[model samples]
Target: MEASRQTSPPDSISQDVNPVFFQQLRDLDIPEEAAKQALLHTGNVSAEEAAMYYFNKLENEEADGDLMYKMVFVVNMDLAMGVGKIAAQVGHAAVGLYQALQDKNSWREMAWKWDHSGAKKIVVQGTSVAHLLELQAQAMSLNLPTYLVQDAGLTQVASGSRTVLAVMGEEDIVNNVTGSLKLL
Candidate 1:
């Protein structure tokens, strides 16, 4: 006896998604679950539109009386530093940026909330030293607190090497600067 195979309806198959849409979501660095939820909520609209919807939803959530803080560390991929070296550089940036903000009374509340909320941070890859510097300039233009870490040549990079650029602020504002970059 032969067994019959069942196939999902065309409508259900259409929801499976195209590879290009998934790729776009990956390129945007959206989490897999978030992408899925966005597609579902948006009725499988174009990737760009879905992304906009997702980000808008996030912004709305943040605006509803709960502020979310985020710190982004842009590390120069050209340096090719070892994991330990990169960690050290990020550490330096985080501490330096925190101390700098702590000294300012206006920013102390942000720093305190960030610390209390677990200090959310994302490490993104930068193409080169110039790229990191450009990001720092952009952050400054946005009036976001930024710190650039330069190594002392004790280990991996040369003296005065710009290792990492750290930017800290509200989640939405920080994303405006680092959203295009991919996670390291």
Candidate 2:
């Protein structure tokens, strides 16, 4: 007598977040960064403004290649589920997949590895990209490679994949990579 309802898988839902959502995420980052500067200027910066300021600093430095791409590891359960489902659908080994789901650090490490392997350039994403840039600058001051992965774009495509991580090199070039990531 009762009708049944099915729950949609998480990946299906996550993939639906369009370039517009990415743009909003970028837009929201500005105020968040400013608030953070306001806070640090006083006490606590809003998430958005803090992110924007960091992004700007990275921009001004003219850091290029993998140092300019925006790469993010989806550690959140809801977020990772989408990627997990895709892997599952593709028939990767079950144990390896399960381990990936369970270990956030391992997942991040794997993502980083994939990022640096083939491409000299990398892109970063997520709420943490700005914070990561701060650390990158510090490392740069130490005469080390900051490896700042810049945001490519929401709708743009470089390789066959659409992950935020767009690898760049001397041969492959594009201007205003982050131009697409920020709010107009």
Candidate 3:
């Protein structure tokens, strides 16, 4: 009699998620349950598309008291930038990204949460311009705010050099992008 019975997981838990797609979103630090919901809600579309939808959905949802936000600066290691130069670049990235968030109500809310949560910040080393761009792309795909700093010729780096990439969002989501990189 038991062998004839059919059962399924709870409705809240999606069973049809694509493993590869799930892992991609997971790599971006989305919670396991949220990733499953994204896959289910988006009908298992491409990972990038699902991630974008998940974050966009978050932007419209009511703020949660426990949500943690953070900011990360990825310095261009290839530039051979001095400590002082790196400091200036990171400063620029922080202020610029902060200003960018003010334009969006949801982002402003996230920023407020971050500010009240000790405004956690991390500095990480990026291999090159390509690496920075790749990380920026991943962040953007997940709807995270990014600000890339460009150096002027008068400074230590060449004019138009991509100096730093700053990404801001929920702590875990932000970690999905820069967590693998080494600390600066």
Who wins the lDDT comparison?
A: 3
Q: Between candidates 1 and 3, which one is better according to lDDT?
A: 3
Error of 3 at 79 (Å): 0.3
Give the TM-score ranking, best first. Answer: 3, 1, 2
Question: What would you estimate as the lDDT of candidate 1?
Answer: 0.83
Estimate the TM-score of every prediction.
Answer: 0.64, 0.21, 0.65
Candidate 3 residue-wise lDDT, 1-184, digit = tens? 4568645655444558877899899899987767877787788988988899878767755454367788999999999999999999999999999999999999998888787545788999999999999999999999999999998868688999999999999989999999898998
Candidate 2: tens digits of C-alpha lDDT, residues 1-184: 9999865545432332232333444465543323333334322234344445446654654554333222222111212225444333223222233344334664454345333332222222323434334444443353222132222333332222222222121221222222223220
How would you encode candidate 1's per-residue C-alpha lDDT over 1-184 as one tens digit per residue? 9999966546422345544675687689976656666666677778887789778867776787758788999999999999999999999999999988987786788887675444788999999999988888888898889999989999878999999999998899889889999998
Q: Lowest-lDDT window of 10 residues in candidate 2?
A: 164-173
Q: Candidate 2, residue 89: CA error in Å?
A: 4.8
Question: What Cα-based lDDT does every candidate model obtain?
Answer: 0.83, 0.33, 0.88
User: Which sections of candidate 1 miss by over 4 Å?
Assistant: 1-64
> Which has the higher TM-score value, candidate number 2 or candidate number 3?
3
lDDT score for residue 139 of model 2: 34
Worst 10-residue lDDT window, candidate 3 = 6-15
